[model samples]
Target: MATAAGFEGTLAALPEAKRELARLMLAARQPVPAHPAPRSGAGPVPPTALQARLWRRERTHPAVATGSHALRLTGPLDTRRLRDALTGVLRRHEALRTRLTGSTAGRPLLEVDEEPVLRFTEADLSGFTPQAAAARTALQITESASTVLDLESGRTSAFRLLRTAPDEHVLILASHLAVFDGWSSGVFLADLAAGYREGTGHLPPPELQFPDYAAWQHRWLDGPDGSAELACRRAVFASDPRARRAAGGFERGHLPVRLARGPVARGLELGAAEGATPFMTLLAALGVVLARREGRTAVVIGTPAAGRFAGALEGAVGQFTTVVPIRLDLTGGPTFRELLHRTRAAVADALGHQRLPVDVLFSDGTPPPYDVLFALHNYPAVPLDLPGIEVGQLPGPPARHLELYSPDPAAALACVGLVERDGEIGGTAEYNRHAAAPEDVRGLLTGIEEVLDRAHTAPASPLTPRH
Candidate 1:
């Protein structure tokens, strides 16, 4: 609905660093013409760009594209109600019932089974000792999480209930990442709890489904709008020479880091003074560290953006995430406060044009623009309250096979993920051992922490030589 003149006026108000990128996006923006409604009966619909990429990678490395969530329930649980809830969730989300049909050699299509049945496996470990039961439950959950889903057969979801005691049970839900994501995990739990409290019959069906999204995405990308968007993205990266370099090979290693509440609070305060969010603040700190470590004036980092900008897509669960490359310019030895403003503008510009699929940016075997990935997991917390049962969340199974099946296998030299819990920030830094040593990776994390401290304590201190 935005006119080109109005849009240009808005971009003109952004920071100087953000102007060019925003202008390119403005050029790509066009009035969306009315299109036919998405195909209803899903015989075989085209997959979203991200889904198709995952499907291809999955074929080469089976069993590696899986995601799972686990919950521990205390107090008596009614078996009938639990079954109904599980069935209701499966019936509600079509992505769980979808399968990839056709040969891998050609473009794959999605097929949804109208009346899919949910058949979850159950285990009773109450007979064993408490510790033994816990160990056995973990083993079972890991096995289930590692199981390769049969995409062609629509066997993409696995649910397991392990009863350690008559009143205690653990529910583990696993599904292919091709059809699921972090946001979907929260949706699944919320829907399940709702269905358990109020019978599934009372719940209204979602206005849209994942298949509808896929169909729409296909049409949009094949049209003039998609072409303009792609061109805009390509121009943004083409202007940056650093973004053209290839990523290093993969050799995964992890290091855990935690920041106390004091520094985190101060950092937040400093960022707020500059009109920046926590993500932008932390990203500025990261930029400082990378600039200092590599001794460069500029750096590019990749971050994931949730593509569920539409209201209808919010409740519909599916893989709707895209990796957006954020480029930072730190040439003038800017203070932490200055850097924060620059980062804020850059992130805003990138996210404004996130609808363009990242895969299309590098279709000719060119590596992803960034070698380091950053993610802040701020997913909505869905609380599950059954009538008399107390539900507690347990850490989900680890993604051990991510290295083999990751769509962007060579795109990341190191990846950093941060999550806030109990007033403290904790995260893991995963690095490619082939490219960086453990000690160096440790030092990089340490540097990030130090930069964060400096940002709060002396916001005006320059990160590099002012001259």
Candidate 2:
């Protein structure tokens, strides 16, 4: 037997070949499993054709694990009333409880074979104080554990409500983004409130179920030239050199800046008088932020555009987002309108090249090194009203984990997620912690907002607002 440090001493003395031999010997000594991965009920047969394709693709890349955003609220409410209301929400949304499985060859995918049941349980707070119980329950949910509520003490909650208040009464909920996006959050909240009312006998059933959207997506994504669109997508995705590499040295992932918080200074919008488009306004605002931060007049910003140019893929879920490069150059102390024009032209160029993949582009040639990544999402429509319950909207959840991890702060990118709602546009700026500090990130957004306010609030004509 080797002494505590004997192995290290022996290895240092031996030739590299001998060292390799010892490592192989140790590995061979370890037992190997005879089998892996258990197969169960063959779960939900692909209910729709689109789902079939997803199941096949996911066979190789298992659907990314789902995560939840939780909220805690304290209020005086009825338990039976809440449980009944929840059942209604669960029954309405099919994607909420869906799961998937497929063969090694990646066909004959399975889905809807078994409906994942709705989970509604209570916690026991018999011994601990109310606050303690609430704290325990919060941790339990955060750590992905199921808990039973002690209804007797006021420990009742749902995993689907988006917002909550804690103190005398609390309501909590969790949602998986795999089936929901930012746009859907607003709709879900509207419906939940309506659903609650219906549950308490305030109204009738909802006009439609989530499955309706599923059916619509199937028809929409499978429409004509959808294959062509995908071909173009392949082209774009294949263009990037870094994305094309067989391996990357970066660690799998470790999330820094876990939660980003700050007031959202007002956002930018195209006024009725101006012939400005939302994309143009967005690019202009971001250009200001970039210019302010880098102390450079000309800036390059990269944003992801939904490549679903064809209406067919409109409802087709899955990650159809593409990274498009937007370039904004300020020349001769350009006026706000001139700045806007430059921004718009850059956006057009990006959209034109959106078909090319980032990996392919990098492989062919490197992008001018500078600026940031700007992603704008025009997500699909989801139902906003359920038959019962009052739903509330909360701050978007912070992404705790990212797989495409990088330690190099200036590794040539920063992503800003922007979404336009009604007429107001709001978004979050995501940057590598190693590259951008929280204060710096906040300042960047503020600069954008300041410019937008300056432009929009100024005399409706060419007059700029007082900053």
lDDT of 1 at 89: 85
Report backbone clashes per prediction.
Answer: 0, 50
Compose the digit string of candidate 2's lDDT tens values, residues 81-132: 6666665545454444454444354534223312234465555443566667
What tens-digit string does per-residue lDDT give for candidate 1 at 1-467?
A: 98867876887698754664454343235344333234433445777777777677667767767777788999989878999998888889888889887734486778788876786888899999999999998887777777887677788888899999989999988888778887888888889889999989855657778887777676677678778888878887775544323245565677776766677678878888889998898888788777776667888778877777676777877877777888899988888889888999999998886666677665767676666777778888888878899999887555532242234655556777788887778877776776667777666566767787877777777778311
- The candidate that wins on TM-score is 1
Superposed on all Cα atoms, model 2 deviates from the true structure by an RMSD in Å of 16.7
Worst lDDT run of 10 residues, candidate 2, spans 33-42
The residue-level lDDT of candidate 1 at 251 comes to 54
TM-score, candidate 1, is: 0.87
Candidate 1 has its poorest 10 consecutive residues by lDDT at 27-36
Top-scoring candidate (lDDT): 1
The true-versus-predicted C-alpha distance at residue 118 of model 1, in Å, is 1.4
